[model samples]
Target: MTEQDVREVLNGRRAQAARNDGAILDAARTVFLAEPDAPIGAVARAAGVGISALYRRYPSKEALLATLCLDGLRQFVTIAESAREVPDPWEAFVEFLRGIVDADVHSLTVHLAGRFTPTPEHRDLAVRAGALAAEILHRAQQAGVVRNDVEITDLPMIYEQLAAIRLGDATRLRELRRRYLDVHLAGLRTAATSYGAMTGSAPTRAEAGARWNRTT
Candidate 1:
């Protein structure tokens, strides 16, 4: 083939590969979030890609799960960072919470945590995300907008609780989560406007980490 023709073919192949990768990751998120125990074949079917093609990109199901969780962590970090830029402290906190809930990254934490071993990259991202989240929380608390009783550690459980609400219809499920999230957010306001003092201790960092640590 001519050099120009060869170059065109190579470029086409690269574009196709990028598209396939995007499809596979999107499918994995939808399939795994809907059914955490789903087999790799399900993801392949959902992605409209061959099983061999999926395996070529992700050698094992564990690897794919890790990739999905890593993506979720990246999204978490992005949301928190964006919220930190909001001028209003309370708005920043609300934006962070709402963005997280809408992103539904917590669903991965709830359904897929411990399914795959975390890598060093995962730990680093998790630390960054935690720090950003803490900064948002502390800023709101200092502004006397958020209740002081709420701890940074309380957020994981709160998100997980919202993530646990499920329905066959994604739209309905999301609306329900938002409804409950609104109620939860109201309760998270300053004590004068809150229901009462937050009861029970927040989950410790170690306790929260236990969820992500591979059991095996």
Candidate 2:
């Protein structure tokens, strides 16, 4: 083949491969969200691509899952980073928590993060997101908007408890989460200090995982 012809052919192949990769990742996200243990073949079918093509893009199901998890982590980091821009610290903190729960309600990655050991990249991204969340929490506490006793770690458990409720209807579930979220937000305020003694200890990661897994 002529040099120009060969270059054109290579470019076309690269474009096609990129498209296939995108489709496979999109399909994997949808399939895994519905069933975390879904097979590679199901993802291939969902993506409308051949199994060989999917395998070419992602050698294994785990690899595909890692990509999905990484993407979700990036999105979470974005939300937390954006929260920092809000003028009010308390509002920023509340919105950050809201973003996490809303994303968790729609995507499986956040839930998976709780269930499985994170990859190094996933862990790093999560830590970055957590740092941003911690900053927001600290700002709120310093402002005396949020209760002094509340720790950053408490936020995840609150989200977990709120997300654990599953109404069969989508509309009802959305409303329920929103209503309970408002209640939880209100309780987090400093003025809501009428409650009795608080527990000093929080659940370990393993304990939290076990509790959530039981509910699932």
Candidate 3:
């Protein structure tokens, strides 16, 4: 083959690999979220890729879980950073909450938390996401957009609650999440007099971190 033809072939192969990788990751999230113990073969079938191809990329289920958790953290950080840039505090807070609901990172945490060991990189990303989220929450509170009773630590639980809505098909689930989120958002904006003050304490950072298996 001519050098140009060989280069074209290599480029095509790379593009196909990228496409396969995206499919595998997306399928992994859907399958694992539904059934955390589902076999890796299920992910392959869901992605419409061969089992060998999935294994070639992920090596093991643990590897796939780690990648999903890490990617979720990256998504959280990206959303928070973008939301923080919005000119309006309330709008920024709403954007951040909506993004979290869509990303559904907490659902991954609910299902996959004790299944794999986290590396130092994972810890760093978690800390960074936490810090960015805290900044966003603080901004909203300072502007009186969010209730003072809300705490930074409350966010994990909020996301977890939203993630628990697993009924219905994809479109239906999306609609339900948004519907419930709007209700929750209104509550966050002001305390209901009948509800009184937010009782009990938010989950401590330690309590949240305790769920994950950080050690190898």
Candidate 4:
């Protein structure tokens, strides 16, 4: 290769190392959110980086707060992806709703979202996901299955509420989950069920394997 190309490659590696800063921040979210009182050294260890490196990147605890705000946008993509339909559009919305409600399992993700001022890139990703959800919600509304009043943005807000409830008390979490499902099932329109047979079956391991590339 030309000397210029070699220099470019060397510079790219340096740039990559600088960009790696965000990964450590992401890891920091997992620790800080789980235990806000945890020390910086602990967060550094949790992130698998040296304490000096962590301090060098984030001089103070307060600096990390901004990154947490950006995480909400990232978390919602998983919500949107889960909401997407495979064989049928309606079932996709239901699954998407379920994914959001079940986000109790992703506490770190939720913590990142507690404050929402996502970076521009993250915000754009969120906008794309929201558009997809709006289409699905609109279709469901047209079919008279989903609540007509439920706006697209409401999905994220509602999911946050459910996450809050889910995280609050272990004793109530199970009952709350069951009751939530029961309410969802009760609200289903008779016509919503008509498409059930058309949709056929849940994704199996083989079908999942075939569809893996398509899904990502």
Candidate 5:
């Protein structure tokens, strides 16, 4: 074959490969978000790609999930950073909490992956996001808006509960979820405090993973 013809063919193949990679990632995100433990074959089917093609791009389900988890973490960091810029610390904290739950609802698989088996990159991103969340939480606490006993780790548990709201019927479900979330947020306010100290230890990653695995 002529050199020019060979070059054209190579470029065509590269474009096809890139398209396949994008399709695989998009499919994985959708399939896994609905069911975090979905099998690799399900993702391949969703991508409309052969199993071999999917395997070529991601050696294992874990590898694909890790990538998704990392992306989700980065998105979360962006949201938290943006919320931090809000003029009112209390508003920023409330918005940050809501944003995390929204993210988890859209990317359930990433949420589960981070808690269960995070890659090194995912872990690093989680740490960064956690630090940002801590800062937002601290600001609210210092403002005497959030309860003094609230811990940073308690944030994930709140998201977890929020995520439990069924989304099968989108419109009605969202309204119900919003109501529940509003009630929960109101409870988090410092004025909601009654008398005694808040009980229980802050949630750990290991415990979070165990709880997630139990549900899935």
Candidate 6:
């Protein structure tokens, strides 16, 4: 009933409002990505809020949609880390390569994937991913399991082709890409004269490089 109590009540309301708005943003993304034309009620249901409450904050469904797409890319980057678990460096590289292929053709680089520019934070994450691949490739090469001529930075382009070919023909694409990777890896494993034979003994810990444990 007092002035101080009234102020506290208003402040609490404002805080709750902000939290509701944030929840709407998150829920909007999930709803639309799950089904772009999903009803407003669906968004409310997904958000654990009411339909009226959703509209009260975002007047237009379009506004809510735009927010969803804008936020989707960050989530994509977060999901891309699932490919980093393979232990062998060459296989680890393949895991990342295949992941990019799926991402480009199916999600992150696809139409509804949203235009998430590479921010410094995102770019740094990308750098870490690439560095991890390179380290793995280096180790694989040292183990005589991969080609020595391969460059660590060439991974991105390899993935692009893999995705494109896969989209065009899934079976042939996998065969060709796998063959190319095997041959490329073979070359990197040994000298041109030796034809990159797998002459090394059991893989040494040092030759495996740092184990990839991508933070999701």
Please, what are the lDDT tens digits per residue for candidate 1 over residues 1-216? 999999999999999999999999999998998888899999999999999999999999999999999999999999999999999999999999989998889999988998999999999999999999999999999999998988999988889899888875878988998899898888898964545676789988888899888864
Summed over model 6, clashes come to 8
Candidate order (lDDT): 1, 3, 5, 2, 4, 6
**Model 2, global lDDT:** 0.77
Q: Which candidate is the best by TM-score?
A: 1
Off by over 4 Å in 1: 192-195
Q: In candidate 2, which residue ranges exceed 4 Å CA deviation?
A: 1-18, 105-117, 165-173, 205-216
Cα displacement (Å) at residue 179, model 4: 5.3
lDDT score at residue 5, model 2, on the 0-100 scale: 100
Q: Write the per-residue lDDT of candidate 2 for residues 1-216, one digit (tens) a residue.
A: 999999999999999999988898888877877777678899999999999998887888767767777887788788888888898988898888788777663255344544444577866886797788889999999999998888777787787787777776877877788789999899899988778445676666565435323222
- The per-residue C-alpha lDDT of model 4 at residue 203 equals 38
Q: Which stretches of candidate 5 lie over 4 Å from their true place?
A: 1-19, 105-117, 169-173, 204-216
Which pairs, if any, clash in model 1? none
For model 3, the superposed segments whose C-alpha errors exceed 4 Å read: 191-195, 214-216
Residue range 46-156, candidate 5, lDDT tens digits: 989999998998898877876776677788999999999998989998788777766653345434544346557766877898899999999999999989888887877
Candidates in order have lDDT scores of 0.92, 0.77, 0.90, 0.59, 0.78, 0.56
Highest lDDT: give the candidate number: 1
- Clash count per candidate: 0, 0, 0, 1, 0, 8
Considering TM-score, where higher is better, how would the candidates rank from best to worst? 1, 3, 5, 2, 4, 6
Better of 2 and 4 by lDDT: 2
lDDT of 4 at 21: 76
lDDT tens per residue, model 3, 1-216:
999999999999999999999999999998998898899999999999999988889999999999999999999999999999999999999999999998788899888998899988899999999999999999988997788888899988888899999889888988999999998898888554347788899888888888896433
Better of 1 and 6 by TM-score: 1
What does the lDDT come to for candidate 5?
0.78
Better of 1 and 4 by TM-score: 1
